[model samples]
Target chain A: MVAIAIARQTVREALRRRVFWIFLIVAVFLIGLGPVLGFLTPKESQTIMRSLGLAVILLAGLFITIVTCIYLIPVEIERRTIYTVLSKPVQRFEFVLGKFLGGFAIVFLSIAAMGAVFLALVYFQGTTRGPDAGVLVWLTSGKFPKEMVLGVVLTFFQMMLLAALTIFFSTFATPVLNFFMSFGIFIVGNLSSVTESLTTSKNGLTSAIGKIIHYMLPNFGNFNVQNAIIHPTTEISNQGVFIRNNIIYALIYSAVLLILAVIIFDRREV
Target chain B: MATVIKKYPFETVRRRMSLLPAVLAGLGLAAFMQGQIDPDAKQFHPKDNFGKTANGGLNNEFLLLPLLGFREAAAGLLWVRCDEFFHSGDYDAILPLVRLITWLDPHAENVYITGAWHLAYNFTDANERSDRRYIAPSQSLLEEGVENNFDIPDIKFELGWQRYDKIKDFKGAEEAFKLAVATKVNKNSDDFPYGAPLKTLHILAHTYEKQGRIPEALEEWKLAIARSEEMLARSPKDYSAKSLHEAEVRNYAENIQRFNNRYSTTGHDSVNPSPYPEVLEPPPGSADKTPRSWDVAFKPELRIVRPKVFKVGGQFNSQDGARIDVRITDWNYQDRKITGTLNDFSVDPAQTILIDSISVRKNHFEREMDMSKDPKMYSFSQDFYRVVLSYNPRTTAPHLLDRFGWSGEGMTDAEKSHVFMDTDPDRTGTAYIEGQGAVPPVWDGKTVPFTNHSQPLRLIKVTYKISREQIMNQKPISENDIVSVQ
Candidate 1:
C-alpha cells in the first residue's frame, strides 16, 4: 500500500515537470506533421505516414523514459525530499520499485498517446492515396491491425526496460551522468548483434570477450518489430513464440535491474 | 559500538545476498536467450556488405542515429535517389546506391530484381559502342541476387536473359534458364504467369540451337510444346500459350525436316562419291587402266557479270588465255579508289589457274595468261574458267559505296556488277567473274558447237564431262589450284 502511494506520488511529481509537457507537445507535433511530410511523397504516402508515426512514437517514449527517470531520484535527494520519504514507513525496496513503476506508467501513457496520433495519421494518409489504402480502409471500417498494436505494445515494454535502467542509475549517479550512461546502454544494447556475431569467431580471446558482452548487455533489437508492421511480408511466422520470449526477457531484465537499485538505495546515505 | 557495527555489517550482507539468486537466474536466462536467438536470427542478416565498409564494418554514423532502426526509411530514401539517377541517365551512379539499399533491406525482393534489371538491360544497352565492359558486371550482379533470393524465379530468369541476349553466352544462359524453371516448378506461385515458364523454355531451346546442339534443342522444343499444350488445356483462352504452342509445333516440324535432310539419303554423302575410293585407284602405269576422258558439250562464249557501280569486261583470247579488263570511268570521288589482285581464277571443275595481281584502273586494264604454261589449266574435253577479284577501298572516306552512285536498293543487273562495294567501309568486297571457252581437244573426236551468253552479277555455269580414266590421271586437284582456259 505504501509502495502504491509512492508510485502515485512519483507519477504526480513527473507530470508536474516541464520536461513531460515539452516531450508531449513535441511528440504530438511530430505525429501531426506526419501528414504534411507524407505529402512530399505522393506515391508512398502510406509508407511515409507509417514510418513517421512509428518513429515519433518511439522517440517520444525514449525521451519520456530517459528525461523523467534520470532525474527522479537525484532531484528527490537534492531537494531533501528523500529525507521526508525515508522518514515514512516505506521500505527502501518499495521506494525503488514504486519509482520504477511510476516512471514506467508515465512512459506507457506517453507512448499510448503518441501511438493513437500515429494510427490516426496512418488512417488519414491511407484514405488519401497509396497502395495500402485498401488495407487501411479495411482496418478503419472494422478490422484492426493486431500486428501494429503488438508493435506498440512491444515498444512500450522496451521503454519500460529503459525506465528501469535509468532509475537504477539515478539511485547512485548524478542526473547528467545517468543520462549519458542510459543513452550509451541503449546504443550498445540495440547493436548487441554486432558483438554477438563476433562471438562466433574461432579465435578464443575475441570469442570469449564477445560472449561476455553479449550475455551481459540487453538485446534491445529483439523488440523492434516495426519493420514487420510496415512490411507485412516480413512478419514473424511464430508471433506467439516471439512475443512470449520478449515478455519473459523484459520481465527478467527489469526485475534484476530494479533489485540492484533497491539494494543500492537501501545502503546509501540520504 | 563493536556489537552494533558487526550487526549492521551482517544485515547489509544479508540484504545484498538476498538478490544473488535472482541475478544468477537473470544471467542464466540471458545466456539461454542468446543461444536460442543467434542461429535462427542469422537468416535476417543482409547477405552482402554493400553499404558497409570494405571489411564488412557498419557505418557508425548511421548506426548511431535512432533512424537507422527504421530500415524502410533508409531504403525508401535510397530508392528515391536511384530514381533520380535513373532519370538522369546516370546508370553508373545508381549501382552502388541500389546495392546499398538492397543491403539495408535484403528482404525487399523487388529491389534486387529492379537493380539487376537496371544493370543488365539499361547499363548494357547504354554501352552501345560494343564496349562490353559492363556485361560481366551486370551478369555478376544478377547472379549475386539469385544467390541471395533463391526463391525468386524472376531474378533467375532475368539472369538468363542477360546471359542470352547481352553476353551471348549460350551455356551460361542454358544453366540460368534451367535453374529458373526448376525454381518456378518448386515454388508454383499463382502470380507467375504461364507465359513466363514457356518463354524461358523457348529461349533455352533457342540457345541450344545456337550452340549447334541440334538434338538437344529438338528435345527442349518438344518439352516446350508439351508444357504449352498443358497450359492451353488448363486455360483455353490463353492466347500466349496458344501462340507458343503453335510456334513450337512449327519449330518441331522444321527441326525434323532439317534433321532428315542433314542425315538421310539427300545428305552430302549420297550426292557425292567418296574421294577415298577414287584416290585408291591404281596409278597410270598400273595394270588397272581405264579411259578417263569423256566429251561434254557446253557453250564456250558464255559470260557472267556482276553489275555494280563500276563496269568490267572480259574476253577469251584463244592465242593466249582468258583475259578480264576492269574499268571505272564514273569515279567522281577522288578520296577513294578500289584496288586488289584477282588471286583465285579457276578453269573447269576445280582448278585455280591465275594466281596473279590484276589492278582495277580508271580505264581498261587487261590480263591475258598463257594456259599452256601450266598443263593443269586445260581439260581434255572442255574448258571453263572463273576469276575472283578482291577489292579494297583505299580511302578513309565514309559512305564510299553511297558516294559512288550506288543505290543500296533497286539495282539493275548492270548496276549490280558496278556497285560491288559493301556498305561497311571497313570490310573488303569480292566480285566473281566466270566464263567458258572451247579448249582445243587433246584427245577428242569432234568439237561441240556452242553459243555465248552474257549476264551481269550472275555465276557463270560451266558444263563438262570426263571419263573415269582422265579423272584418275589428272594432276592432283585442290580447291587452291588455279587454272585458266582459252
Candidate 2:
C-alpha cells in the first residue's frame, strides 16, 4: 500500500513536469507530418510513413523516458520527500521500485498514445494507396502494416528498460550526471551490431571486450523491429518466440537494475 | 579490532548473491535475442567511408538518422533528389545516387526500375540517339536489383522489359520473365500477397511468341489463364482484382484458342509451318541427301578513321534483308559469354564492351561509328580488342525473320553458317532428330538445360582481332585484319 501510494505520487509529480509533454507533443507532430512529407517518394511513401512513425516514437520515447525517470529519485530527495516517505513505513526497495514503476507508466502511456496515432496514420495511408485491392482484405492484414504493433510494443519495452536504467542511476547520481551516464549507455547499447561484429573480431582483446559489453548492455538494438515491420515481406523465422524472449529479457534486466538500486539506496546516507 | 568478526555478515553476502541468478538469466536472454535479432543498426556503424567512411562504404554520422530506423524515409528523400537530377537532364549524376538510394532502402523497387529506365533511355548522344553504351550499366543495375529483391517480380519484370525493348534480346527477356513468373507474393505477395503477379505469366507468353516457341507460348497462355482463374476463384466477389484478372483470362483464353487453331493442328508441331527443309542423308544418290546451301557470301570490312572511331562496311547478298551486330570487347569476352545459357543483364565493369547493330541496305552497309565520346563507357585501354561482326536469325531484320525460322532453318552461308540440333533426351549430344526438324537449336541462348556449352550461334559471324594501336591510329587499318571465326 505504501509503495502504491508513492508510485501514485511519483506519477502525479512526473506529469506536472513540462518536458514530458514537450517530447510527446513533438513526437505526435512528427508522426502526423509523416504523411505530408511522404509526397517526396510517391511509390515508397507508405513505407516511409510507417518507418518514420516508429522512428519518431522511439526518438520521443527516448527523451521522455530519460527526462521523466532521471529526475524521479533525485527531486524527491532534494525536496526531502524521500524522508517523509521513508518515515511513513515505506521500505527503501518499495520506494525505488515505486519510482521505477511510476516512470515506466509514464513512458508506456506516452508511447501508447503515439502508437495509436501512428497506426491511424498508417491505416489511412495504406487504405488510400490501393484502388483495386479491397480495403477489407487490406485491413485484415494485406496492406495494413499490422506488424507495426510489434514494432511499437518492442519500442515501448526498449524505452521501459531505459527508464529502469535511469531510475537506478538517479538512486545515487545527480539528475544531470545521471542523464549523461544513462544516455551514454543507451547509445553504446544501440550499437549492438557493432558490438556483435567485434565479438567475432580477429583482435583477441577487442573480441573479449566486445563479448563483455554485448552481454552486459541493455541491448536497445534487439527491440528494433523497424526493418521487419516496414518490409512485411521480410520473414522472421519464429516471430512469436523472438518477441517473447525479448520481453522476458527486458523484464529480468529491469528487475536486476531495480534490485541493485535498492541495495545501494539502502546503504546510502540520506 | 574485532568489528570484522560480526556474525551477521554471512547474511549480507548471501543477500547480495541472491540477485545473481536473475542477472545471469537476463544476460543469457540478452545474448540469445542479440544473436537472433540481426539488428539493422549495422548500416549506421559500417567500417568504412571515403573519409571517416569509405566510398560505397558508409559510416557518416549525419547518416545516423537512417541508422536509427529511418532508412526508408532517407531513401525516399534521396530518390526525390534523384528525380530532380532526372528532370534537370543531369543524367550523369543519377547512377551514383541510385546506388545510394538502393543501399538506403533495397525494397524501393521503383528506384531500381526508374533508375534503370533512365540509364537505358535518357542518356543520349548529340543527335538524341540513346548512347547504347549505357545499356550494359542499366542491365547490371537491374540484375543487382533482382538479386537484392528476389521475392518480388517488379525488378525481374523491369529486367525483362529492358531485355525486350532496349537490348532486343528476346531470349534474355523470356528467361527474365520466366524467373519473374516463378516469384510469388507470399512469394509474390508484394501486390497479391498469395501469388506471383499474373502479368509475369502474360509477358512470358508474349516473349515465348517472340521466340517462335508457339507450343510453349500456348502453355504459358494456358498457365496464365489458370492463374487468373485461380485468383478469380479466390475472390469471386472482389470485382476489382477479379475484373482486372478477368480481362486477362479472356485474352489468354482467346490466345490459347488461336494457338490451338494455328500451331496445334498437328499435336507434335513445335512451330507453325514446320521450320524444316529436307537435309537429306548422304548415300551418294539417296533422296535424304544434304541439300545444297545458299551463299549470302558475307564479306565484312572495317577501317579506323581516327582515334576512337571506325568505319565498318559489310556486304550481304540479301538487300535490306539482314542486320549486323557489330561488337567490340575487352580482349577475351566470348570466353566469358559462352557460359550462362540466358544472355542476362550482367555486365562486368572490369571489362570494356560496346555493341551496336546496323542494317544491310542494297547488299552493303557503310557507317562510321564514333566512340570518341563516352570514354568512360568504352575505355579501350586493353592491348588487343576483338571486333565481332555477326548476324543471327532471331534478332536480325524483319526480312530475315520471314525467311529463316527460329533455328535458322531456311538460311545458310557457305563460309559462316553452322546448324546444330539436340539429338537425345539430354542435350549433351547434338544431331538432328529424324522427323522433328529445326524447331530447336543447339543453342538459341536458352533450351539446353546444362550450364557449360559452346555457342554455335552465329550464322554469319566474323571476328577480327585488332590491336588497340590500330584503334588509337598508331597502326594503320588493312583488309588483312579480318580474322575468320572458325
Candidate 3:
C-alpha cells in the first residue's frame, strides 16, 4: 500500500510538469508526420519509420531523465525544499524512491504517448496494405507485438535505472560538475565496444586508459533495446542469458557509482 | 502514524531502487523464454508465408494507388537524372533506376512487365536469330507480374507470345495461351483481345504438321485461314487491312498449291530428244578429204574454238578433295567438240574433269564442289561418239538411249544422268576456268530441231549429289590431276 501511494503521488507530479507537455508535443507531432514522410520517400517507408522511432525514444527519454535528475533535483535542494521534505514523516529512502519514480513517470508518459502514435503508424501501414504474408514470419522473427510492448516496458525500467544513477551523482556535486560527469559517463558508456577494442590494442598506455574509462563509466549500452527493432529476425536465445547478463552489469555499475555519490554527499559540509 | 520518522541512509535508498531492475529483468526473462518454442514455426513454412503476404499486401488497392503515383514521379525524375548515362548505353544507370521505381510501386505491375517485355521483344530478342538470354529475363519479369496479378491477362499474353515467338517453346507457349484464353473467356471481357486461343490453335496445327499428320494439318490450316479471314473482316480497316487481306489470300492459295503438288503423279509421255547435230560432215579443204574419207562426218563449227586449261576441284570419292589446273592445248583431238553428252566424268583420286565449253562443243561452265565425296566423272559410251547416234535407235542408234539403264529402264538412267549433269556445285570445293582465256558462258551445244533458238539448259535444276557413305569414305588427292574436258 505504501509503495502504491508513493507510485501514484510520483505519477501525479510528473503529469503536472511543463517539460512533460513540451516533450509530448514534439514526439506526437513527429509520429503523426510519419505517413507524410513515408509518402515522400515512396520506397523507404519502413526503414524511415525505424530510424525515426529510435531517434524519438532516445532523445525524449534522455531529455526527461537528465533534466529531472540533474536540474530539478538540485534546484529543489538549493531552494531548501529538501530540508522541509526531510523534516516530514517520510523516510529518506522513500524520498529518493519517490523522486526516481516521478522522473521516470514523466519519461514514461512521454514515451508511451509517442510510442502509441508510432505503433499506430506501423499498424496502420501494415493493415492498409492488407495482411502481409510475412506477418507470420515476422511474428516468429522477434517478440510479437505483445512481447515487444513488454520489452518497451522493461526498457522504461532500464531508463529509470539510469535516472537513479544521475540523481546519485547530483546529490553531492555542483550542477556544472554533475552535468559534465553524467554526460561524460553516458558518452563513454554508450561507446563501451569502442573502449573494449581500445583496451585490446597493442599500445599499453592507451589500453590502460581504456580500462580506466570502462571501470569508471556505467555501461549504459547494456540497456539498449533498440537493436531488437533493427534486426527483429535475429535468433535471440531463451536462456534469459543476454538480458540477465546486461542487467547484472548495469546494476553492479550503478551501485558502485551511487556508493561513491553517497560517500561524497555524506562528507559534504551542507 | 503521525510521529517523526528516522532519516534513511543512502545505502538503504539505493537498495530499494535495486528491486526495480530485478523485477524488469524477470519480465524480460519470461518473454525471452516464450520465444524459444515459437508456435509460428511449427505451423507454417516462413518464406512462403512471407511471399504470399508480400504479394497480397502489394496488390491491395489502397496500397497500390499511392505507390503508383509515387513511382510515376520517381521514375520520371530518374529517367531525366540519368539521361547522359542512358544515352551512352550504360545499362547500369537505367537498370537501378527502374529497379528502385518498381520497388516503390510493386503494384504498379506494368513497370516491370512492360519494361522488360519492350526491352526483349521490340529490340534484341526480335532481331534475326533471337537472343535467348534477353528473352529469358523478359519472360521472367512478365511471369512475376502474372503471379502477382493473377487475374490480369496482359502479362499472361506477353509471356506466352515471347515464349512462342522468341524461345520457340511452342508447347509452353500453347499452355500460357490456353491460360490467357480461358481467363478472358471466363471473365467475359471484350476489350482485351484473347490472342492466346488463336495462337494455341495455330501451334496445334504446326505441331500436327511436324508430326506428319498431313490430313490434320490441312484441316487445321484451313480452319486458321478461315478464322484469320473472319477476324480481318470484323476488324476496322486500320493500317494492317490491305496487307492482312493479301496475306490471307496468298497463304490459302499457296497451301492449296502445295497440297496439290505433293500428290501429283503424272508421268512424262515423250522423252526430250537431243539437240546435237544429226550428222557431222568433214571440211572440204582438209587433207583427209580423200574419196573414201570424204564420207567421214565432222562438225564444221569446232575449228575456231580454243581448248581451255581449267582448274577443277577433286572428285567426290577422294580424301584430299584437291583442285588441279589442267592445260587443254590439244588442237587436233578428235573429241575436241564433244557433240553428245561426253561423260568425261572423273574417276581419278586427285583429278576432276572441268568442262569448259560445249558449243556444238565449246561453251564455258563455271562450277564448284566440295570434294568431300568421290565426284562422278564417267566417259561417254561408244554410241554417243557415233556420227549417226542422234538418229533413230533401230537404224543408227540413239546416242543417249544406248547408255546403261536406258531403253528398258530409261527413267532410272535418265534420272541418274540428270542428277550428275546439274551445275549446282557442292560447298566444299570450287571449279572455274583459270587459264589464259576468257571463261565462256555455259551452253549445252544443242539447238531445237527446226528452230533458230538454242535448246535451253535450266541452270537452277543443277545440283551435286553425294551420298552420305560416299562423303564419309572420300580420299584426298593432289592438285596436278585436274583435267579439262574440251
Task: Give per-residue lDDT, candidate 3, residue A75.
Answer: 67
Supply DockQ values for each candidate.
0.16, 0.36, 0.02
- The CA lDDT at B414 in model 2 is 65
* Consecutive 10-residue window with the lowest summed lDDT within model 3 chain A: A230-239
Better of 1 and 3 by TM-score: 1
Docking class of 2: acceptable
In order, candidate lDDTs are: 0.56, 0.68, 0.42
In model 2, how large is the Cα lDDT of residue B134? 65
- Give model 2's DockQ, 2 decimals: 0.36
Winning model by DockQ? 2
At residue B458, candidate 2 shows an lDDT of: 25
Q: Across residues A152-212, which tens digit of lDDT does each residue of candidate 3 receive? A: 5545655665676787877776778877777666656655445555666799999888766
| Better model by DockQ: candidate 1 vs candidate 2 | 2
Model 3 lDDT per residue over B92-145, tens place: 455455444444433334455555654454322111222222444465556655
Scoring model 3 with DockQ, what do you get?
0.02
Per-prediction TM-score, chain B alone: 0.47, 0.66, 0.33
In the range A31-84, model 1's lDDT, one tens digit per residue, is 787576543445445455565567667778888899999988898889977767
Please tell me which predicted candidate would have the highest lDDT against the true structure. Answer: 2
TM-score per candidate, in order? 0.59, 0.77, 0.37
